[model samples]
Target: MNFLWSLFMRKPALRQFALLDAQGRCQAFKECNQPPVGNGWVEIDEIRLSWMHRPLPARARVSPRPAQSSRHQPLAA
Candidate 1:
């Protein structure tokens, strides 16, 4: 006998939505905002999202530059 539980089941994945203009540029997100009245626009109803998490192992170290000989030079008017 097999018993199924809701806690062990995976949740349904949701889709993202976006509005694009005539030049294929993103104008609005979540499909909640109203688009312009007279222009060629496209609606993406089922936009999938990809997420990732990556941590860098090490960071680069930068050293300061040495002082130039202009330290003792006088200022000109």
Candidate 2:
């Protein structure tokens, strides 16, 4: 019957790929260059496991400020 068919014919969900670590943790695609402990496809909803694992942009290093002069005395108001 049409009703039975509707119940069984649900739309297929989207598939997502993920890399897992040795402890079964999810890793981001950018970090896939490193050796994997475990790897496989994951559901879209499970993407959160790897969300925080994404590689961050490299930050520029800042040099320390020069030492202040010792003779700089503050004037009284």
Candidate 3:
């Protein structure tokens, strides 16, 4: 069905995996480069994920301030 296909492809609805850390708390993720902790998929009681990645610092907007003013003349020997 087209509805089913859409759900499967939808990144928000599709959970790549969940992992339990040593602290016993479970973390939900959209994806992971490494294998999940349990090595299997299981029904989760709760899930949380941020759909958007934290925006990276844009080079265009960020301009570093000049460390020192050029008005000071250098010492002569």
Candidate 4:
């Protein structure tokens, strides 16, 4: 059982890679099973992993104003 499982279930699926242009747009996609074509391609999975490690920019914080009373005395009619 162990031998059969190792032979079949141990293998992982083919990895998918995205080909990007100079503008960082995806032009095409290719899997690991396919032969390499042109350059400027990156692994789709790596993109998400890299983004998770990136730091976010600081944003300016705004202070809230004090509350004002809206009640007013009635005027003579």
Candidate 5:
């Protein structure tokens, strides 16, 4: 039974990447099974001067805002 359940269950895939805007600020942190593609975005590992507005600082890091929790939702008045 355990083996059958495992076969049916889908495993989650993990991906970590950061997106920077024209000003070099962290616009978003993406996590998906497949690579994300869009305008004004590039992978953190790749280096492309054309995609970046300016050179990033050596100590620069991408720290996007934390995901909001459902518990914080306001009750409808």
Candidate 6:
């Protein structure tokens, strides 16, 4: 059983990278299965002087405020 499982099982996938342009705008954001394309890697002419990291920025979140309750719903006790 162990032999069969090991043969079929593969390694985990790597997460994609996110980048920011010169103007600090999010130019590309996608979970790429393959390596980065042309002028995508670091120290390239296309890439501007911006920060690049494995994880996304904290400010990249979109948490809107809860909508006002038009109807008063009963709370479940």
Return the lDDT, model 1, position 26: 52
Candidate 5 per-residue C-alpha lDDT over 18-72 given as tens digits, one digit per residue, 9 for 90 to 100: 5767777555666665557876444454333443445445444445446668787
Local distance difference test, each candidate: 0.39, 0.43, 0.40, 0.50, 0.58, 0.48
All candidates' TM-scores? Answer: 0.27, 0.25, 0.23, 0.38, 0.39, 0.32
Candidate ranking (lDDT, best to worst): 5, 4, 6, 2, 3, 1
On residues 1-77, what C-alpha lDDT tens digit does candidate 4 reach at each position? 99988888756567656666666655565668443577865555422333332331112111333555598656886
Which candidate achieves the best TM-score against the true structure? 5
Worst 10 residues of 6 by lDDT: 40-49
Q: Pick the candidate with the highest lDDT.
A: 5
What is the per-residue lDDT of model 6 for residues 33-63, given as tens digits with 9 covering 90 to 100?
A: 4446755322222322343433335454334
TM-score preference between candidates 1 and 6, better one: 6
**19 Cα displacement, candidate 4 (Å):** 0.4
Clash pairs for candidate 4: none
Off by over 4 Å in 6: 1-7, 40-77
Which has the better lDDT: candidate 3, or candidate 4?
A: 4
Can you write out model 1's per-residue Cα lDDT over 16-54, one digit (the tens) per residue? 344445544455445334433545333344433321112
| By TM-score: ranked, best first | 5, 4, 6, 1, 2, 3
Model 2: residues with Cα > 4 Å off, grouped in runs:
1-14, 29-38, 44-46, 49-77
TM-score for candidate 3, please give it.
Answer: 0.23
* Candidate 1 to truth, TM: 0.27
Q: Which residue pairs does candidate 6 place in steric collision?
A: none
In candidate 4, residue 30 scores what lDDT? 62
What lDDT score goes with residue 5 in model 5? Answer: 100
What C-alpha lDDT does candidate 2 achieve relative to the native structure? 0.43
